[model samples]
Target: MSVRALVVDPSAPAAVRLGEVPDPVPAPGQVVVEVSHASLNYGDLNDARSGRVPVGAVLGSDAAGVVVRAAADGTGPAVGTRVVALASGAFAERVAIDTGAIAEVPEGLDLAKAVALPVAGVAALRSLRAAGSGPGRTVLITGASGGVGRFAVQLAARAGAHVIASVGSTARGEGLAELGADEVLVGLEGLERPVDVVIDSVGGSQLVAAWHLLAPGGSVQSVGWTSGEPAVFPPYATVGPAKSLTSFVIEGGAGPDLAVLAGLAAEGALTVEIGWQGAWDRFTEAAEALRGRRVSGKAVLEVSREERRAPALLPQG
Candidate 1:
């Protein structure tokens, strides 16, 4: 049997389209989840065209769903459990995810919102920790209106850091103060103080400026490159004190971190801001909105309704 998925299509307008692929078959340590929702990331857009995901391959990394088949090894959640996972090829009707990468979604959190927690949430959590976020530290988050940026701002504040959010415009910087930003700047302008930690998503020239504004021994966790431009530094740019700009990527099993984020969201500590959400069939619209920066936080696509029952499977002797 085959299942529907958003596959990479180099010729399509968004380099992806709804298509059929073989139904997922779970491995001993993997469970088959019937996807309820999937979250889109800026990296997914580039993956479609940059050949990182390959033509005709399913393209997505974050999804929330119900496990239809438990792992044969009895490692993951039991069948019928709702979960969110950071798994590749997640934009499908069903996905086979390793137990280590899937987390049970707590009650009261919408699957659509839970779906937004994987890529963006984990990146924020990990990046902040890597940069040593805590009280008395000033954390600057670039691209503060985007998915990762919003999460970083809130997490940084919750960590007791003085959060400085930098956005492209004042309009995009709205509602950030309430989210725990001590200061929100339209650009890097009107800012005189050097920050101790910089979670920079907008690479290129903004990264260059952020480097200059880094306090001695400060750290810049390079998360995403939404700017799509080159970061040309002056001759003496990197000749300063002991500062670091470390590149970041979400690595390892994300289930534990995802659970933490879901728990926080359920308890009202973290807010999952979905800038756009709709049926998966409208993926093109969602992609365009995200690409044009019309979506502020996250873009989620509903893949299916909640299913309480898993399809009947053959019994083992």
Candidate 2:
């Protein structure tokens, strides 16, 4: 049987297109997830544009769904368990992912919301820990309306840091105070106050400004380069007493961290901001919105509705 999926035609110079591919069969230690929803990130936009992913790739990063088939080695979650996973070819009616990348969805949490956690949540969780964010530390999150930034804001606040959010526009900064940001500003202009930790997603000028805004003994965690510009901080920016600047990407093997984030969302400790949602066929619309920074939070896609009780065979395209 064939299932619907979105594939990136690397040479065609487009974002994504829907097509059919053979249904997945689990390998040992892999589970076949009947996808319900997926979360789109900024990196997804880059991959789509530059064709950074392999040619003819089914491009996607995170999904949440019910397991339709467990691994033959009996190592994955039960076939019926709902889970959030980070995997390749995730923009599909179904996805085959390793057991290690799948985290059982916490009770009473929507799969759509859980889908938003894996990529951004893992990055925020890891980066905050690396920045030594904790109670009494002042943490500044740039691009605070984006997925990783939103999570970092809440998680840092949960960790007892006085969270400050720097957004692209004053309008986008609206309501961030409710999301655990102690202060919100449009840019680095008026908020010259130094912070103990800077969770920077908007690199380039924002990154350079943030580097200069770091206090003595402060750390700047460079996560994403949304500005599409090179980061060039002055030498003196790094010469401060005990100041540090480091970059990171989400380490893929983070099932436990995904689970922790799901639990936090389920318990109301973390907010999963889904700024846009629609059927998977509208992927390009979502991608464009995200690429233009028109989306303040995650743009999620509803890949399939409910469980596919029986795999239906559709016309081979």
| lDDT (Cα, 0-100) at 233 in candidate 2 | 66
Clashing residue pair totals per candidate (backbone < 3 A): 0, 0
**Which portions of model 1 show Cα errors greater than 4 Å?**
304-317
* lDDT, candidate 2, 219-248, per-residue tens: 899898888888786665566488888878
Residue 242 in candidate 2, Cα distance off native in Å: 3.1
Q: What is the lDDT of residue 203 in candidate 2?
A: 91
Residue 271's C-alpha lDDT in candidate 1?
A: 90
**229-292 per-residue lDDT for model 1 (tens digits):** 9999999889968999999999999999999999999899999899999888888999999989
The regions of model 2 sitting more than 4 angstroms off are 10-14, 305-317
Q: Pick the candidate with the highest lDDT.
A: 1
Most accurate candidate by TM-score:
1
- TM-score for every candidate vs. truth? 0.96, 0.93
Clashing pairs in 2: none
Candidate 1's displacement at residue 286, Å, is 0.5
> lDDT of all predictions, in order shown?
0.92, 0.85
